[model samples]
Target: MKKRLWVIYGMLTLATATWGSAFIAGKFAVQSFEPATVAFLRFFGAAILLFPLMWVMEKDRKKPTLKDHGLFVLLGLTGIALYNICFFLATKHAPVIKSSLFIASNPVLIVLLSGLFLKEKITRNSIIGMAIALTGVVFIITEGHILTLFQYGFEPIDFVLLGAVVSWAIYSVVGKVVLKKFSSVESTTYAVAYGTLFLLPFALAETSWLDVQEASLTTWAAIAHMSIFVTVVSFVMYYNGIKEVGAAKASIFINVMPVSAVIMATIFLGETFTLAHGIGAGFVLTGVYAGTNPNLFKRKLKGNIVKNKTA
Candidate 1:
């Protein structure tokens, strides 16, 4: 049991590391392809693999009704299509590390939206953590010059990146609804399929078969890495880890993502890490820890209380 648990942990770590590397891959891919074209190729490849995997894994699952298809389409739009388009666009314009930091703060936005749409309770910690996380995001966006934000307003790319965060939040919230009807693998496969279809027209507008054929090996390799390792393999491992260790424990591994992204961006992209990025990362990770582990302080308090009573 211990050995198997360790294996799960290793898988989770590798999964998150691959997710982090996706930033680097996206940067490389967008250098050669249009944002929409890059997104389309990545998901098109992923959809090809995910469909067969879903079929094999979910043979016992019931067929989706028309209503379920609607929900899947929503997931496809918000999570897959919109998120990736924004993601690639942001990567094209922003430093991969900075863009990744913005995405690292995604859970805060998700929590906020959950409160509004899903009626999930927003705890005191969640609110405080969100404030801290947003502060960190501001610092990252302004590059330590918070006053510049007031003077100049947000850059165009900031809104594009925020679009990615918002779309992902919507996807997660909608996924809660979809999960009630279908397995994760099933829903994800359908969503990817639909999302690829949605991107097809946009991709067609952006590029031709000749452009695709003319793309460098680096671009194809980046797309393959994102599709195979980041999308399919990591997702499977992450959910499996969640199943084995529970969501809270599994979520802790997400902290590894931004750290890995920063390292890869530095090494592969030759991007310099600024002091502002360091501070922002600190706050963002701390805020995510506090927000996600809502019961952490309560548990510690209970332990202290019991110890005091014994004393």
Candidate 2:
């Protein structure tokens, strides 16, 4: 049981890394495609990949009901279609680091929504962890001087990223309920399909896809990465991890994302990392670890005692 849980933790960590890197990819892709068009192509590709795999894997499962389909459409609309549109648009106006940090706020929103909608309990440690993690994010956003946030005020893109955060929180909370009724693959596959369908008209109205032919190879590769790895693989791993653990615990892992996003942006997008980013990441990671493992301090103290006795 412990080993299985560790594996889930490892996979969830990987999923967060991919999700973090996606901000960079989306930043690149939006240069070539409209926000809605990018959302459409991404899920359209994801659906194509997921459908056949789901059919092969779920041969013994019962078919979905009409109500199930409706629920999936809702998931597609809010989680995939709407979330991606907001995300891509935000990328156009904000830097990847700032946008990802704002999106990282979703963990707190998820915990709250899960408590309210899913009847999950909110522990004191959870609140403390959330507050600490959010503090770290604010540190990064403000570059160590939080007063700057109040003085400079928020950019328009900040609110757009906030919209994406709300959409994703809804996705995660509602997804927890849907997972009880469907396999992770089934839910993700159908949701992607519905999301793709939802984006079609908007994409058609907004952008000429002829731009796709003109896109550089780098852009296409980024889109493919977003579709396959970020959307399909990472999402499956994330949902599976949520099933194994719970939403609150799983959401904490997302604190790792802003760190990963900053690193990726530095390496690939030529962004600079400051001391504030390092300090904020440290606090965020510590808070997440403590929140998820309420007994972490006790266990560490116990380990120290054992080591001293051996010495």
Per-model TM against the reference: 0.78, 0.88
lDDT of 1 by residue, 172-227 (tens): 67776666567767767888889999999999998988887789999999999999
Model 2 misplaced regions, further than 4 Å: 93-101, 152-162, 297-311
Task: List the global CA lDDT of all models.
Answer: 0.76, 0.82
Q: 150-185, model 2: which lDDT tens digit per residue?
A: 454568777789889998888888788889978888
For residue 178, give model 1's deviation from the true position in Å: 1.1
Q: Which stretches of candidate 1 lie over 4 Å from their true place?
A: 1-17, 90-105, 128-148, 154-162, 236-257, 273-282, 299-311
| TM-score for candidate 2, residues paired by index | 0.88
User: Positional deviation of 292 in candidate 2, in angstroms?
Assistant: 1.6
